[model samples]
Target: MEAYRLLIADVYELAGLSRRTSEEMARAVGQTAARWHVLSVLSDAPRTVPSAARRLGLAPQSVQRVIGDLVDSGHVEAVDNPDHARSPLMRLTGQGRRALDELFARSEDDRAAVVDRAGVTAGELAAAREVLRKLAGALRTSVPHP
Candidate 1:
């Protein structure tokens, strides 16, 4: 019980630290956290705003705003959706791919810094990732959805 309580506090701390570092990296790539997240989710495939929002666990309107900004910046493009006529699927453009690559490269140093600071072995980090995944799955079940 004490271990679980400590784990929860540690996870919250880690989440805050990660978000701050990620925001800095995103800013360097000319994106906000929301924009970066949207681009990342679309990296695999084009998705409607609603789909992207759901995956990101964000409001659709918020995601839509970020999507619009991405489009305006030519980082992403909207294509005709076969399934939905009104909502087009958003895909990354060549520039978007380049930006993502650049972002990753820029953030690599930050990631390394974190690992060095934590002094954690690769195996330990892997284990941490598995634990976090399990925690997320458990929490997802208790969260309400619209």
Candidate 2:
């Protein structure tokens, strides 16, 4: 339907813009969006690379590369995982937490500006999020994976 097409187009553009903005914010703290995302997830709790990749809906290989970089920078550390010997859980170190927190602070103002500029209420954002969540679930079920 025409409506669906328009909605999908908007979603596509929004996603691209969001990623660009996120990357910009991450760069301010000497990190990339990919690395920042990994650190953000690990900030909540430790997760193996595969687990984190699954949660982020990203390829394990890509996440692995970012994790490697994070490890080299001493922002993240691998802790032993009882369930999997080879797959160690990734933990955000104090340095990673600080970096993540700074990134969050930087984005907070941008987020506020977006809401004000768009003149959208919190409820509108929530409703839009719910719609997108449902669409993602429907697509997962209806679309065939390669």
Candidate 3:
């Protein structure tokens, strides 16, 4: 009851914290969080803007804007998309990979510090993640235009 309500608020609060942390991590690599996110998504493989947007749960236009910024910064490059003529596929450049790798390492250190301070066990974190995933899955299915 009340706990569920509290959980909802906590989730949003956590999201804000996550965004701030991500921004800081990205800043360390001389990039904004938005640009970093787009690069990170493309790190897996070359993907069309729409496909990357879908995977990141971001708007295509927003992702496109970030992609433009990344391209300007030499972090990402656009390649031919065999599937779509207009929608070019994007991939991370060497600079992007290096930036992402540095960000990940710093983030890992920050995470370890936070985990130590919070005294949250790995098992507890795993359980919480599973519960959150279930709720997120349900919400994604039920929400309109999620």
What TM-scores do the predictions have? 0.80, 0.83, 0.79
Q: What are the per-model C-alpha RMSD values against the true structure?
A: 2.5, 2.5, 2.6
Q: What overall lDDT, based on C-alpha atoms, would model 3 receive against the true structure?
A: 0.86
Instruction: Give me the overall lDDT of model 1.
Output: 0.88
Ranking by TM-score: 2, 1, 3
Residues 1-146, candidate 2, lDDT per residue (tens digit)?
99989999998899789889999998887899898889888988999998898767788899999999999999999999999999899999999999999999999999999999999999999999999889889887986543
Stretches of candidate 2 exceeding 4 Å from the true structure: 1-6, 137-146
Off by over 4 Å in 3: 1-5, 143-146
Better of 1 and 2 by TM-score: 2
What lDDT does candidate 3 reach at residue 97? Answer: 91
lDDT of 1 by residue, 1-146 (tens): 89989998997898777878889888876777777778889999999999899888789999999999999999999999999999999999999988888887888888988899889889999998899789779877998765
Quantify how close model 1 is to the true structure by its C-alpha RMSD in Å.
2.5
Best by TM-score: 2
Instruction: Kindly report which residue pairs in candidate 1 clash with one another.
Output: none
**Residues 13-98, model 3: lDDT tens digits:** 98789889999888876878887678778888999888888777888898888898888989889999888889898999999899
Please tell me which predicted candidate would have the highest lDDT against the true structure: 2
The candidate with the higher lDDT, 2 or 3, is 2
